[model samples]
Target: MSEQATTTPTDDEQRGASTLELFFDLVFVFTITQFTHAFGHEPTWKSAGTIALLFAVIWWMYSGYVWLTNEVAPSTPARRTVLVVGMFGFFTLALAVPDAVHGHGVVFGWAFLGVTLVHAVLFRVSGGDDASAAILRILPTNLAAAICMVIGGYAHGSATYLWWVGALLVIGVSPLLSTARGFVLRTKHFCERHALVLIIAIGESIIGVGTGLAEETMNLQFFVQVLLGLTVIYVMWWSFFGNDNEHGEAALDDLPMTDRTRTALIAYGYCFVPMLLGIVFAAAGLGMAIGQGERQASWAAATALSGGVALYLAGQALFRAALGLPRPWMRLLAAILAVLTTALGVYVAEWVQLAAIAVVVYGAIIVDDVIGLRAGERSSYLAG
Candidate 1:
């Protein structure tokens, strides 16, 4: 333990997310809020699909930068400038989302293309040779996507929307085509960044409840439902962080260097999509449930409420499975039950449906805790 013998970890080991990276995340908060606002106005299948596609695009943009920053320092003035520009580009996209499905499709498309281009540029500049080669490999597909977003922006009707779908398809599959080597991950930085994003997504659900309550007259039922919505949010938080999050972080910390980048990409990168999407859905659902009082939920509201929880559970299951953790199957079963609960909601009040989903999530935690006890392992459920 002598000072000379206790060598300093390399820059790579010491690196963490910078202030600019965090500021960039705040932009996405607004983006998520905009998506929630757009969906709340018209909670239908059409709107849902539009929101989902938008969410997918935004998630990719945000996560792609996260990977880049994990590889290189964003503290340099130039890199910091790029982040600011990207933030504006994302902001443009969020602003256009309200009209993305129709008249402003072109605006949305252009803004998204700008963000993706920024990603490519940042990757080229900071991601090293292997990263550059990976960018080169995916360039053609990304270019095609850019074109689709621009053209689709102006194109009308189903033709236009198809282009959006085409863009997402190309970008979505590019990860599979990547073959560039020598990629590395800063494990602690990567896990912390993702966990922070999940926290922000959870905030969206709380915001949903707040917005919903704003529209209703204050009363006992209103307060009760508000508490219910808040409880559901707590359950969602408990379900993730209170379970394997710390263990998963530890797993990443010890992951072999050879497998680090790919494992982080698969585990944290992709799994977050559904998990964050679930928050958005739950927000919309919780808001509707609160606003409607004793009124029954519309198809969109009920689906959003119940399906959101199901998706979160499923995402968690996938996340743990990707990390080579045990009991992912049990989580999967919980997700299936969540899906079934949505159907059952057809016969119950919306608040009741929301409560049912919360109970189910809570039950999943309890079951896991009991299993841990029987197996002589301490569960995280009761931990601070």
Candidate 2:
């Protein structure tokens, strides 16, 4: 097969997410919101598990595009067209999220399959034989997953879920096949793209708060709840962005290609799933708590509220570990705090629970910042 040189910008060419890439991400903003809403509507163990499974599917699809864009320059007409169509496919997938378990599973499957095939074709066209061959090795795994998705779509109840699991299993293990030949990840663009996606996920949490409270009559308590929610979001943002962000960039920039690939795969690839999961969970909790207007939370709602924080903090810790950085002891502590607060949530008013969670997140950020500051103005990996 003849490989055409792609006009797509590589790390050597492009430094940050392009305008078209940003446009591509807009669809996912709605997709993440849909996931949060789905969980909010049915806050149960079963619902949570199903949504988590669906999110993995959704996240993997988007991440493939991110990797594609990172490798290719979007300057070519072909690449641009591919991106535009992929965006529509992603939007269609997002639309199918609410009813994915039952009625609309086929629609979800087709959209996902379209996006996956598009990514594979584009990667094949732009990459050399080695690259094409790597993609080829991985293609079967993706196709297998897509097929399972189709089967899952047609099936119902437990059978549908089993097929989706089959799909995820194929996707999860497939990456191992191509691990020996890592792909190019323009450090700056790669880091920025992932960061932007996380920010979008955080935005989803805020949107969740707004949607939840939109039904309530305007009052001081409503404003207070909104304020507290925003504070918690801010602190979460700070905890991730304040110190961790630079270290991640440094790791990507400084590490050798094989190490960089491994780090990217482990940290950004796998770790982000839980982080996104946590954000969605937190958003679901916020929506429930705010909508109820300071009512004492039901067991499900309280668990959603605190469980979300625990998951988020735990995801952060894993992200740090993946980068070969010092583990985020404070975040681990916060995760523990989250679980404890969740336990406390059962006894307290919903608002009190929200406030307490915010305090724990904020305290973690403060502690982490102090430790980083005390470590002093050390140079980043970029300096070398």
Candidate 3:
């Protein structure tokens, strides 16, 4: 294949996220929606596990595209065409997610393979020398994982799960199998791309609230419940957007190229799994709980709502720590308390449980802000 010398952003000319990248992320919105709706329909532990597994596979590839775009901007006609083809693969994957665990595993596997192949080809053709060399190192594992998914698709019963698990394991340790030293890190575009995805994921919670409200009467009680749910979503937005991105970008920028790649992989690639999963679960829970606020929440609904918040807070803490930022004691404490609120839903009204969980998270943000102020820093919850 002829190599296309794509324009790469330099330190002096850092670029923000592009319109094409944002367009690509729209497919991801559908991905999240499908998962949220699936779990909302069957808010059981088994379903949650299936969603988590599929999400890990989908997210790994999705984030790979983010890394790909960070290096080789889809600035050329050929690169743009390849990216759109990848988007179609993602859309197909999302469509299969609703039935991935039940019956459509083969379809899911094929779609994933298409997406993976597109990633490898695009990197090789447009990524220039350094990125092309770096992609070659990780390409085997990427292809291996996709093959595992294809095998898992044809698998039966427990064997199916086993094959998918193998795929996850292969992709999970990819960084260890290959060195990250050959890739370039454009901190600005890298941070912006991730931030946009995170924001879009968070938007799923709002969609959840709307879906939950669809069948209910818009009474004063429903309005209050909506407000409380939105509050939780708002806090989720604030937690990351309120300076975490800046801190994360700055932290990565300070590191050497190789260390920066590793840290970005851990901080953005791995840490974001929990955060995104948390959003998925929380959206599922909130969608289930909204209209039925007066009644006691089902075990699945209660756990999904509160546990989702806990997962997000814990993930945020890990992200901060990976960036060598000060430990978020307040967020950690909130994670514990968020988990404890699961009992509230089981015992009390679901709205009451949601309110309590919201308090826990909002309180953490407030405490962190106070601490930041006291330390003479800006009012950033993650500021040391």
TM-score of each predicted structure versus truth: 0.91, 0.93, 0.96
Report the C-alpha lDDT of model 2 over 193-248, residue by residue, as the tens digit: 88988887898688767866656888888888888878878877777777677788
Query: Relative to the true structure, how large is the alpha-carbon lDDT of every model?
Result: 0.77, 0.80, 0.86
Worst 10 residues of 2 by lDDT: 1-10
Q: Of the candidates shown, which would achieve the greatest lDDT relative to the real structure?
A: 3
Model 2, global lDDT: 0.80
Q: Extract clashing residue pairs from model 2.
A: 8-72, 8-73, 9-73
Better of 2 and 3 by lDDT: 3
Q: Enumerate residue pairs that collide in model 1.
A: 106-153
Q: What residue runs in model 3 are displaced by over 4 Å at the alpha carbon?
A: 1-3, 6-13, 379-384
| Candidate 3, run of 10 with poorest lDDT | 4-13
Q: What would the TM-score be for candidate 3 when compared with the true structure?
A: 0.96
lDDT of 1: 0.77
